[model samples]
Target: MSAQKVAVITGSGDGLGKGIAKRLAKDGFAIVLSDINPDTLKATAAEFQADGVNVASFQGNVAKREDQFALVQHAVDTFGRVDVFVNNAGIEDVMALEDVTEADFDRVFDVNVKSVLFGTQAAAAQMKKQGGGSVYKIINACSIAGHESYDLLGVYCASKHAVRSLTVTAAKELAKHQITVNAYCPGVAATKMWDRIDAEMGKYMNTQPGEAFEKFSAGILMGRPQVPEDVAALVHYLASEDSDYMTGQALLIDGGMVFR
Candidate 1:
């Protein structure tokens, strides 16, 4: 077993997940990157390697329970132990509530909710097996939508709400094992996911591309759009010893979007 700590971040091929992985790597944790997209995952692993990061990459669908388990196993196989597991893989559905079909509900919930639940289970089991004094962290990726619902993102919001619930329940259950489960909720961000949201929302709102994103950004009290670093900073805190006493909380890192 290696001496350095290990962290497994799902959907780390791009965007916020990638940023979090980089930040943790800089903090001296060996990183295991997982993504459903093989190309992006390979590229990201290469980039991290070039940057002198102790990294491994796994390609898997996070929505599957088996895949989530396999991701944790990969971390253990490559590194010594898993100290932090971030369930950061999620999908956003941009559609009116009336147009949300069963398929849409399943698609959103499977990736956003099911993945977090099973991912925490897998990480906690490994942490229990290790049985050291070290704190094991399970950080989930939630959204401001989890707190307040928007018009076209009802299903996505519901899925994130489920994430928050899972974080709280898992924290309560895993406290005995020294595993802390918490979530970071981000608002409007300058990422490819938000680009898609902006484009899809344009279709409904009858606005041009980038217009919807501008409108959403306008609501941010910080007077600036969110960056991946903003979210990564929060995740870094949750993963570090500084947040050892914090759990069961879905913290909003959205720059004053939802004030709850």
Candidate 2:
């Protein structure tokens, strides 16, 4: 195994995932970035390489069990050992709870919940092989929706709630293996997800674009919108030895939006 830690981050081609990959790379990990979008994956890999960071890119859908396994194996193949796995690839579906189709529910759940489950399983298997010790971390991408159910975001909320549950259960089960499982619950980061959310909620609420996002941001005690870097900082902690003792916890990194 290589001396430097290896981190495999899903959906890291852009948005919060990209930020997490960058921050972790800055902290000296050899990064393996994955995304379903091949173009985005190539672009992010190039950007990281330009900054003198060691990075490899893979294009795979996070919702597939086979793909999840491939991501972990790719890390091991390229970097020798896997130290961190970030299940950050997720999508949002903003529809009225009443109007939500079974298909929509399955898609959202598959990407947000199922991906984390299998992704964690895949990573843990490798971490255990690397000596069944707390030398590895599994971080899930949760959201404020996981904490509180919102109107149009019900399905998305449910999916994240499942993520939170999985994080706890995986932490407990993987503890003997010395693997830490945790999640970062971000509120309203100004990413493309929120931009799409703003537009979709506008359609449901009969409001203008940006209004829903503004309203949510207005409620933050910090009085400002969260950037991707805010979430990345929390991830940096979770991925480091500083958080070795922390697991099974879904930390709220949302500008004080929901106090736990």
Candidate 3:
């Protein structure tokens, strides 16, 4: 068994997921990066290898339960044990409630909600099998919408809400196994995902590109749009021993966007 901790981050090919993987690698964990995009996954793995980080890459859609299980298995096969598993793969749906179709609802929920549930199940099972004395963590990627609803994002918000609920339930169920499940809800980060949201909102609001992003970002109490590093810092805490006593909580790390 390797002495270094191991963390598996899904959707880590880019954006916030990639940022989290980098931070964990810097924290001395052997990283297992998983993503549905093969090219992006391979590129990210190469980047980490160049940086001399102990890393592995797996390409899979986390929305599938079997794929989630395989991801955990890959982590264990590559690195000895899985200390932290991040359910960070999610999709954004920007459309009015009435405009949402059944496919849209299913696509969003399957990736955002179902992935978290099964990912936690797989990680918790592995953690339990690893036995006692080790503190295992299942950190989920939630959003500010999880705590509050937003226009044109009803289904996405609902999916995040489901993620929060699963986080709490998994925490309780896995407590006896020394596995802590918690979630981090981030606000308006300057990522490619936000770029897409901005574009969609532009069409809905009849505004130019970047206008919607500016408007949404202006509401941030911190007076600045969120950066990936900010969210990564919170995830780092949750992955560390410092947050061992904390679980069953959907923490809002949105720079004062949503209170409580």
Candidate 4:
């Protein structure tokens, strides 16, 4: 094995994924940044390049099986090995249960649930081939919603709940191969996802802008809304040897918002 590690992060064009990519880069991992958006992908690559990070970008949709496999292949081809895989690409929907369209439900679940399943499947193959065990890690992007259901986010919550299930199941099954699987559940962050959540909630509940976001943030025992870095810090630990003993655990990093 080479002294340098390689990490592939999905939805890494912006927001939390970008944060994890940067953190892993700082940890001395050559990174493969994957996203569906080409422009953001280029921009993020430029940002990392400016910072002198070992990074590359892959434009792909995580919901597609071929893209998921190609992402892992890209990392191996570029960096020579895959050390970490972060399933962070996800989408959210804000609607009453009765109002959710079939299309909306599928879109949410496809990215949040199916992506994790296939992404992990493809990455695990590489890890197993690379001589598995503590040599590689699989990290899922779970959420506070995964632990506690929220109103108007029924489909999104359920999808994340599925993530929790996959995290545990994958951890148990992959342990024999020496590959550890875990998840970090993040609270509301000021990312575009939360902005959309807040905006949609405002339209649904007839509230002013930022009102919905504030209401949720106020509930956090941490006294502030979470940042991408907060979530990335936990993920960094999970990706490193420090968390090798921990597996199949969906950890809550929501600042005491949800006690689990």
Candidate 5:
């Protein structure tokens, strides 16, 4: 049999990751699920299998190079080649500048930035061998914080800003090889991550999780706070042949927070 389009979505066993993986599978891209969560990893794979989509799973810590290497290598070994890579695994640290410990900052950078670097390196090596591919980094809804500042999320914003910078740099650096490196910065999406952020940062919405979620629909001019599937739809587009001409851009999927 000939090779099918294959995508490896890191941290894709649940939430946004799972949504992206399922979308890719539906789009006919063979889906390779990677996450630190082994049980969810297998469950996602089996679920896709039941749907008759080509699927597989790999468990790896995003902060580790060897793990990243294995995931890319497995993509090649199992599916012939990788056509897309999504770096979607991340964590948030909600402490002020002074309260943010070195260890905490390091941990955030390790997963958010370092992992993407190595993961991109691994994907690029393979993509280069196979001609080229696309890489998408799913950055959180960093609020105005990514560009400005929030009360207790300096570290988280810093980490995302780092990812944003790295993405632009990679776009320019990788263009020559036909590898498109880009990031999707979605504003506040109602997910587990958002729930955690809300709990730590206090009532940004003045309501509980569900209540707050509905209240904070949009910032000034932005449409609304997003859902995982909302971001997933855009990710689906970027991973396809339709976005071949796009590269080296930080496409903001947020409701207009940054421009405001």
Candidate 6:
């Protein structure tokens, strides 16, 4: 309703989500940053405020439909319209096929697959009512482990493959309503989630974090790792007019690692 465009980004407390929010803000969208972590949410919101970017903050778990619904609600209430919704809040639990626990699988699916489903649904409803807007999901490069397989990361791979499928399906279903659904698949980016996981895994495996991070980036075609901002740029393009004609596609932003 406001003249300025509005963008609601989840997991925006840090890393990929924060980067996407920042980029979209620069692209002229008022930002609503959401995350389950309250301190981080406040901190991230402060960033946009300091830069004089129109911004708001909310704390909620993406997996909860009620919470997810409130996310959009707050943005609309604060900004008066929702022009873009970036469902970037997701978690992955790296586990071996045989060692995968029930809790581990559920945790990954709840946020990565289920939350994405509902987040898109909620945003699409708003967009459909308002005529149209863009919905994007920032799914990490699961292609390597997804298309093929890497050791101890099977669950994460499968969850991302599910996300890939979901993105295209939503795109096709929502296109008729003038809403576009797309995904940015980043290859081993330096997000907070990845950093924490790398540190934990490195300690467990008796390897340096650099060694682990290097091995992760080795699979990419560029052989150089990705930073959060790299993925954010693609997210910006996907959420903008330039990509209006593009929908139902998972655009790989993974430094060419997953391409055949």
Q: How well does candidate 3 match the true structure, expressed as C-alpha RMSD? A: 0.7
- Which pairs clash in model 1? none
Model 1, span 1-260: residue lDDT tens: 68899999999999999999999999999999999999999999999999999999999999899999999999999897999999999999999999989998999999999999889989998999998788889999999988998899999989998898999999999999898999999999999999999999999999999999999999899998899899999999999999999999999998888998
lDDT of 5 by residue, 49-148 (tens): 9999988889999899999999999988898888889988888877668887879989998988888888888988887877633343222222334565
What tens digits encode model 2's per-residue C-alpha lDDT throughout 126-199? 99999834458999999998899998999999999999999999999998888999999999889998999999
| Candidate 1 weakest lDDT stretch, 10 residues | 127-136
**Steric clash pairs (candidate 2):** none
Between prediction 1 and prediction 4, the one with superior lDDT is: 1
In model 6, pairs of residues that clash are: none
Candidate 1 local Cα displacement, residue 202, angstroms: 0.8
Model 6, span 67-109: residue lDDT tens = 8888888988898878788888877665557878898898988
lDDT of 5: 0.76
Model 4 lowest lDDT segment of ten: 127-136
Clashes of 6: 0
Looking at model 2, how many pairs of residues clash?
0
- Give the backbone clash total of model 4: 1
Best by lDDT: 1
Global lDDT of model 3: 0.93
TM-score for all models, in order of appearance: 0.99, 0.98, 0.99, 0.98, 0.88, 0.91
CA RMSD per model (angstroms): 0.7, 0.9, 0.7, 1.0, 3.2, 2.5
Pairs in clash, predicted candidate 4: 133-178
Residue 69 local lDDT, model 5: 90
Q: What are the runs in model 2 whose C-alpha is more than 4 Å off?
A: 132-134
